[model samples]
Target: MSNSPKKENLVSIIMPAYNCEKFIKDAINSVIKQTYQSWELIVIDDGSRDNSVGIVKELLNNDDRIRLYINEKNQGVSATRNRAISLAAGDWIAFLDSDDMWERTKLEKQVTFAKKNNAEFLFTGSSYINEDGNYYQGIFDVPKKVTYKKLRTHNVISCSSVLIKKRFFGSIKMEKDDMHEDYAVWLRILRTGVCAYGVNEPLLIYRISRTSKSGNKIKTIKMTYKVFRFIGINPFGSAYFMLKHIMGSLKKYRRIKFIN
Candidate 1:
């Protein structure tokens, strides 16, 4: 790390919005307010039926850092995000959902840690916002350095809280499954033998509404199965991992005990 200014460390943020008119402005502003600069913001519009694109346009007009992409049709979130990734130009890459907001220091903190420890890839901790923007408590039990075993039972990276070297994303084309696409992408990246690390600090605030596509339990279950399958894990182990994850989530958060 030198005091000299160089173009070697540009952090690009890829955020794709769809029908998030209520919160898109705040999300866009969060990036603009970041303590760490030298980043590009690529916001993809996934054929939002609401005023999401318009709000992004307004934000874009206000700040030249923001760029917008309106999809030709209503593609899934995965496609929209991949589009953003394709257009990004930075040494490091991060993803933020349209409905999520980051603390002003989120990028600065995570970038500092990655640079200091030489952890080329890492994810920051995150908080949750109820549909109405109320805070929700999180049960934190993340491993300091994530490996295949840790990720098997649960996913540790929030899409909005991740930052990685540009080489990682370019190596693996993230699959376009709407459900658990990010997780599947991570798994593929892991198979490439890159280590994924984590920061314990909660620097992101995620908005969780019942209307969220990921909130659908049935869909999550199906996606969990699909993600494991894509990695070529054996069917029996995939089923075991899925059950363990669902039940672990139920026990930890839902407070439902299960008996074998």
Candidate 2:
């Protein structure tokens, strides 16, 4: 018998699109090229004032696994993801952003690893790319294992790299769009005594956008503080963690050498 996961191991990929017309097609194409065949792409367009929706529609004819939905208005990322989760039919849930791409074997390798280890929550390391899709010199490394406390100090799990069991969605849903919504969800899941397994390979290609919320240092600081508060950390404790978060962010970016 093959150790490979069966065809029934369907992975529902959640993608929230907004004004990412320039890269959305490439992102979708990356999914189409996945080595794992049992998967579905759920794309929710959050009222993007671009050709993002049109681009997705064009690809619908090529593959039946790709499904597209549109929001009536500009619902935030958290809400959009929640909506997508509600529609997902797979036993495993993976997230991929509209502007990012993945290695062709990302799903294949991650699924195999999860089955071998009996892991419910998993994420992989990422490599960086600029707005123009130029590669950065270094890869963002993730630890072999991450606990709740370790994740609180620094978020090594990129949203686009996560692959989690769908059962956890019963209680874990992304919230608080103004802050790090995905981070909050990951922390919440980990708080339940589940450790997240990490594959330290650059399976994800993260696109660094200057206009993104994380690009604004001051705004990111405020949001990081709010994440602690949202998770029931007191003001003093939040402050302590906030300092650690800042230090971690600095250390993380210092290693990435951008070619552009």
Candidate 3:
């Protein structure tokens, strides 16, 4: 494969919005400012009761690359993302959550890195920002490569940092809203003997929201257990993995710097 930027390679960015009026603008703006220009942003509003749709519409006036779809009812994030994926018209699919922002050169760098490494499934390291958009102290780094076994012990992949080929998705869709839906999909894909390449750059600026599901420690632990079981791990096996997951999480979070 050529190392030069493939101008013809279209990237479909999937963003699911749900009552995120305050942050959606920043999220979309981050995309609008991307150095990689060959991309279309598909924003699906999952029955947002707030002005998230209106904000997206306002931005739509200036950029034809951004498209918005509203859900008839409140479907969860997994379903909303699946719908967006179905509507994607690009060869590569990138995901950006409504509450997160990316570094301006995120796509440009990731695309170049992917091509250089011949990577079909790729992710990057991330830094954190609080709800007020203030930066945290440390970056969340990722290993150079990860497989099914490593990922099961600890999911270091943030959905926002993922840039994968559309063909690899095939029939695999995110499921089980209560668990880590994205993690489940990654596991299923990696189980097929494929490895996920990681770029240890803080390309993703993840927003740490106290209201988000992952913010609740107990709830997240429960969800982690479910993810193990959902992937066909027996009770004993799930318990073993759960212990590893918890220990890994504890160690991971210790390095992160939160707002004082």
Candidate 4:
């Protein structure tokens, strides 16, 4: 990976960590291996009780672009991500969860695609992986462009595959205490007339674990209903969207499981 800096278009990567020591190394190394050279990785440790901080520190020694921040006490992912977002000094902000990894050309291709289409918010397709790092089926099949109306009923954006312009950070900060906080933020951005574009190619390895927050199916459905309510949709409208979300989720999971 070339460390040479480019003069323009620096993308800042935001990573929020909890007790993710097992997969943190691959995540950080994925950033280091990116073909795009002009970027900074800001990793916020949310009071991890493991060696997650130590692993990050070791990687920081050689590269000045990767910086680590710490929270004295445990904070939620939204709070940790907001801290990193505040410190981002780039025109574009990309996200990579601590347990997820990216392809080497992920950033390189995204930068070109976003610029080409003049998109403010963008997300790419992602492949799924199990706890053992075993590959699963390609679960994400993103469309060329997603509108606010399209996203109201379903959220197709993945946190790790997002590359958003920094201008929206001022108005749309992530909501704390929300199970689908990332989905809420995307809806908020789209409401402001920003169209979310998708690259339609798998650029991220999204890890699925039984212990993860998203692993609980029942809770996810509950939280998704809450998301629609939080966004101020009426009860009838919320029901319609919630049903759509549930059906889509079931269909997607069934396809993935059958393939495995």
If scored against the real structure, what TM-score would every candidate get? 0.90, 0.96, 0.96, 0.95
Task: Give the true-structure RMSD of model 2.
Answer: 2.9
Regions of candidate 4 where Cα sits further than 4 Å from its true position: 1-8, 258-260
Note the Cα lDDT for every prediction shown.
0.78, 0.92, 0.91, 0.87
TM-score of 1: 0.90
> Given candidate 4, what's the lDDT at residue 58?
92
Expressed as tens digits, the lDDT of each residue in 1-260 for candidate 4 is 23545424888999998899999999999999999879999999998989999999999987889999999888898888888999988888999999999999999999999788877788998888888888876467888999989987777899999999888889778885656888888888888887999998889889998987789988888788888888889888888998999888877777565234
How do the residues 148-214 of candidate 2 rate in per-residue lDDT, one tens digit apiece? 9999999888999999988888977888888998898999999999999999999999999988888
Model 2 ranges with Cα > 4 A deviation:
1-8
Candidate 3 matches the true fold with a TM-score of 0.96
Model 2 CA lDDT for position 236: 97
Query: Where is model 4 poorest over a 10-residue stretch in terms of lDDT?
Result: 1-10
Screening candidate 3 with a backbone cut-off below 3 angstroms (N, C-alpha, C), the clashing residue pairs are none
The better-scoring model by lDDT among 1 and 4 is 4
Q: Output the better candidate (1/2) by lDDT.
A: 2
Determine which window of 10 residues in candidate 1 has minimal summed lDDT: 251-260
Give the Å shift of residue 250 in candidate 2: 0.9
Predicted candidate 3 versus true structure: per-residue lDDT over 72-188, tens digit per residue = 999999999999999988889999999999999999998898879888899999999999999888889999999998998889899999999888778899998999899999999
